[model samples]
Structures are given as structure tokens and as C-alpha cells.
Target: MAREKRTEQLFVTVPSFFRCPISMDVMKSPVSLCTGVTYDRSSIEKWLALGHNTCPATMQTLPSTNTTPNLTLRRLIHLWISQADITPAISKQEAADVINGEFDSNSLTKMIGFINSSEENLKFVALSNHAVPKLVEAFAKSDSMRVLELIVEVLDLISMENAVREKLNELILKSDGITDYLSSFNLVLQKGNTESKVKSARILELMAVNSDSQRKIAEKAGLLHELYSLCSVETETSAVEAGLSALLAISTSRSVKKELIRFGMVKTVGKILSGYDYSSAVRAVIEKSLKMLEMVATCTEGRGAISEDRECVVEIVKRLMKCSRAATEHGITVLWSVCCLARDGTAQENVAKVNGFTRVLLVMQSDCSSNTRLMCGELVKVLREKNMKSNLAPYETKTTHITPY
Candidate 1:
């Protein structure tokens, strides 16, 4: 009863045939029990595994537990997904004009459909017509969250083109049409639901790969701060992963690292890492945050921010035990950055104080990648040199100047 109520709340008209009798989601691999009611294959499998001989939908006892696939329903679902674009088509000239900034609602709608069509011919023509600027323009003018989300989806598709990326880079530098789109995306982060926010962050992640986009996003550091806030508040793992990915991409620009530091990203990420239980859903977040922290720590300000939080360093050191080579490499790289670049003494002191040196040495001797081994060796050398210098400092003082304690 509760599941039925929740399903009704989530969708207005899910065709009864499209839904699984057990789970209620659209059936991916529908199967039928002897009792004649259909359920998703996995759902019914679990039902039978639990010794259930009754049909969930009809409450009738089944004579046999054997299942049969509903191929007709599966084929119907495939056709529906393929023909899901209900938008009307437009002429190439109309799409061209829309890309050129003409802004007809009908034409824009058709262009969105064309992009969604995923036909190589449509993709080529869209790129040939130069779509990035007008897409941003359309996105900026959109008042509806649904429209904004559609524009972002189209933008994500076109951003893959080299020409589109170059044009986007120029626009970001000039704060032209791109900035308006960015402003709207910031609003999405603030007001849109979890799905829209996830889509927006993913679009920004793709854009941030371009150096100009990174600089442009850093200029609006408040958006990055909002992403951090989203990471902290979102219960959905995918949303948090998207948020972290966007930050990671933005941190790739040398100019953007300080903004991340200013937002206290290291501490924010550390808090997430500390609470996460090991699951497939959270593994991506853990890997992404470690990589982003590595990039951020390359800058002096970032090193200072991370070093200020003792637990951040400790958390990073803890990751050396993880089986992921990428995670371990990033973790060590951040430690190396703090030890080598931070002018403040706290970063190095914390490394020694936390016994991080031992972990680095242990990983150095393991069967890890060459890069990890090399980073560990470099860190060990630095720690040894710092230790030697500290030990020799007392001996360098003049004997005559020494006073009895």
C-alpha cells in the first residue's frame, strides 16, 4: 500500500503494464509467475528466493515457481524509449537560426529534440551551425526549470565538439553569453531539485575542462561555494559525486585553487570522507575528492588551508591503505605538496606528527604503480632532510652562548 502511494506521488500516469507488480518501477526485464501477474525479473527472483509462492498483485497462490520472460513488454519499453521525443521537428535553417541567436520558441524546442535524437547527421549539422552561444542564450532566457535543464542537456552534448569548446573558451574569457548561462546555472543550484542540480553540475564539470571556463568559474567563486554546500547537504550520492566532480574540474586551473582553499574545501571533503561507509555508491566520491585535493594542494594557499586542518591530513594518510592506486597516488601527492611548498611550518610538522612518514615508506615498498613509488620516495627524502636539519639545529649553536638549564 505504501509503495503504491509513493509510486503515485512520483509519477502521474505510469502505464499499469509498464510497471512491475512487485517493485513498481518501469520493468527492465519483466517476467511472469504462474499466477499470471508480471514483475521485474530480479524482483520476482528475490520473491521466490524468500519462499514466497503467492502472487504479490493478485494475492493468489502459485502452483509453480517457474518464471517466463515477458518479451512483448520488453520490446514495447524499448520502442517507447527510442521514440520518447514528442517534440516536433524543425528545418535545418530554423535550427541554424536558433544557433545564430534568433530565439524562436518552437525552433528552440525542435533543436532540443534534434540534439536528443542522437543521430550523427543531426549532431554534425548542429555543430556545423555553431550551437554553443545560442544554447547559452536560450538557457539564460529560460524561466522554467524544466527548460533550463533541457538547455543544459543540449549544452552538455555540444560541448564535446572542439570548435564548440573553443568558442565557449572565447566567450568565457569575455564574460559574454557564457556568463549569463553560468548565472542561470547558479540559480539552478540554489532552487532546482536534486535531478536538475545534478545535471547542472555535470554540465559545469564538462565546461571546467577548458582553461577559460575554469578561470571564468573561479571568477564566480560563489558558485563553487554553493557546490561545496550541496556536497554537504545532499543525501543522494550521485548529486554529491557530481558536485565533487565539478569542483575537481574547476580546481584544474591554476587560478582556481585559491578560491577552493578560501572555501575550506579540504575540511569539507574530510568531513564527507570520515562518515562514508564503504559502498559502491560512495567509492566514486572518495576517489574524486582525493584527486581534487591533490590538484588544490599544488598551490601554496591550498596547502595552507589543508594544513590548518590536522584531521584533513590524517584522513588523507588513512587513504594510503585503500586498494585504489589512484586514491593512494593522489593522497601522497597532496602530502608531498604540503611538505614541499607550504612556507608555513605546520604542514611538515603535521606530517611527522601524524606518523604519515611510515605509511609513505610502507607504500613505497609495495607493488604499487611506478608513480606512487616515485612520489613516496620523494616524500621520504624530504622528511629525512627536514629531520636532519632539525636535529643539527641545536649542534650549530655556539658552545660559548649555551646556558645551563
Candidate 2:
């Protein structure tokens, strides 16, 4: 019996280097990762899609989701595929277009492209070699309003992280245009359309992330005034929030906080708080404004300003009686500052005039934090101590403390 010869094609094994460590198959479109390993574009892209931030083969951390195309390796793969009579799956030209910077025409496109490429794209772009430098170059070389707007968008995206904010501060300080842009943002704060003003405020907030920048911002001519104006009267809640946010950031500096108090920032913020219509968003506004006021009130100048503004004193006392735990705590801190630092019993007299003593005692008697209760109790004690001394005044000889009900 004659056996028919079996017709079979010989199998050729792919070279180990040519295969994707992820898919364990020959790389159709190879790209070099930052880890110095090559991977097929589709396989690695899928890996990134799965939220992996390290190499599958070596398990080394990837610096960015961005990968450089291994053009030579891909060409070799194409040649190998032809020689092996293997049908190509994906179009080479399409992959080439994807690899090249053909799609990255603008910051928005670049941001979106990276984000669409992988979930880790924001982290990657933020840490990319081009990101910070490009921001500097764009600010330096371009006067285009459209371009600046795009830069702001990029800033908003990256400023979510403190790490990126620090990097941004270093890079931006090097650009004269950026410095000018920040100083001139005061004009935006003054006269720009609401959206522009809001954007300007956001940029200031980013720059004010560090102490050096905070000092620069505080020293910038009319910058704080413009920000304070925005907080005080801007009808747009976004503008108000942005302005308050920047002030809050800068208020962390002792010198800045002193300057803000001298500018009557505490009083302005208190006014905003007092008039704010109650809503979920307004609750945040209330908290930030109170926090800022408390920070300023820690300084002598701030306490003097708060005491001078009868309305602010009234609002703090009212907030102490009506707001959330945080607001009440901040209000107590401000009142304590007012009581301790008020020149010659001015803060104490102001409280007595506005029924603030009653408000403090009410909050103290309520269910509040231990810290809040302690602060409230101290404020009352201090107010009564001042009242006792003030009773020695030539006009009123009656010696009686402020009675809390």
C-alpha cells in the first residue's frame, strides 16, 4: 500500500526580540518603550488600556504612556511577514500616521490624544519631556490669544496634582512673558469678560501654589485688589470661587496674610459670606471665606480690620451660630483673634455692641467639636476680661462682665 505524502508547510518561529512580551507573538508594529523594551503597538496599547503602567516583560515602571515607534524594527517585521507569506492584519500607513506627530496639532488635541490613548495618559503627558518646556516656550514665543487660552486649558488639567504644580511653578518663573502674564492678569481680573477673568483667577491660583510665587503675586501691583474685587462683587459664582481660591492659597504665607488683612481681605470675605445665598455651592464658599478670614485674623492687622467692620463682626457671630462645624470653628478662631488682638478693647466692645457674646455662648453650649468649644469658651472669657478692664473707663464706672445667656 502506497501512503500519500502529507502536504504541509514548514512553520517558522518568530525571533524572541521580534515578539511582543505582552502578547507573546511577533510584533506587527513595534514601538520602543521608555524601559528600553519593544512591544507591538496594539498589544502595548491594549496593556495601557488595561491601566498597566509598567512593562509586562520586566515589570519595570514606565515613565509615560507615550512610546516611540521602532520604525526600523517595524520595517524588518514587514519584510519578515512578506518573506514568510503571512497576511498583514493592520495597515502600515495607518500605524505610521498614528506613530508620527501628525495628530498633535494643538494642546487640546495633544491632551485629548494622550487621554484617548490610555487612562494613564494624563499622568504621562504631565511628566513628559515636552510638557513643562512646551508651556514655557508657548508662553515666551506666542502672543496669540487663542494659544494662551489653550495653555490655560493645559494648566487646568495639570494643576490637579501638587507635583505638577511645583514643576509648573519652576518652569513658568523662567518665562518673562509668563511673569508679565501673571501681573497683567490683574487687568483681566479688573476688566476682562467674566470667563477671561475666571481663567485669569485660576492661573493666579496655580502660580500661588508656592511661597515664592505667592510673594510675587502679593507684590504684584493691584493684583490682590483685583482679586478682592472679584470676590466682593462678581455676580458670577465661578469668578467669586476662583478669586476666593487664590486668596485662600496666598493667605497661607504670613507676609501675604498680613498684606491681605491690610487690604481688608478679611472684611471683604466676611461680607461675601454674610450675603451669600444658601446653597450647596455657597456652603463651600462659606467655608473657604471663613477659613481665609481666620487665617488673616491670626495677625494683628487682620483683627484690627475685622473689629473695624461692624458688619464683619456681626457676620462672624452669626456664622458661629448658624453654619457647619468647620465654619463655626473658623468663626470662633476669628473671634478669638479679634478678642485677643483688638487694640484697647475694640474687638470686645464690637462684640458687646452686636450681641456676639450671646452667639458665642450659644455655639459653646451646642454639640460641637472640643476644639470649637474650647475656642468659644476662651473668646467669652477674653471678652469678659476686657469688659472688666473697660469698666474702669472714665465714662462708665460700672464693673460688670458680658453675661452669656
- lDDT string, candidate 2, 226-340, tens digits: 8877887787666677788888876676787777776768667767877776543355577778888888877777777787887887777766645466677788888877775
How much lDDT does each candidate structure score? 0.67, 0.64
Model 2, C-alpha of 232: deviation from truth (Å): 2.5
Highest-scoring model, TM-score: 1
TM-score, each model? 0.63, 0.61
For candidate 1, lDDT tens digit of each residue in 272-389? 7787764433556777778878888777777778888888887887677552555677888888787765634676666665556666777686667887788788787776666665
Residue-pair clash count for candidate 1: 0
Clashes of each: 0, 0
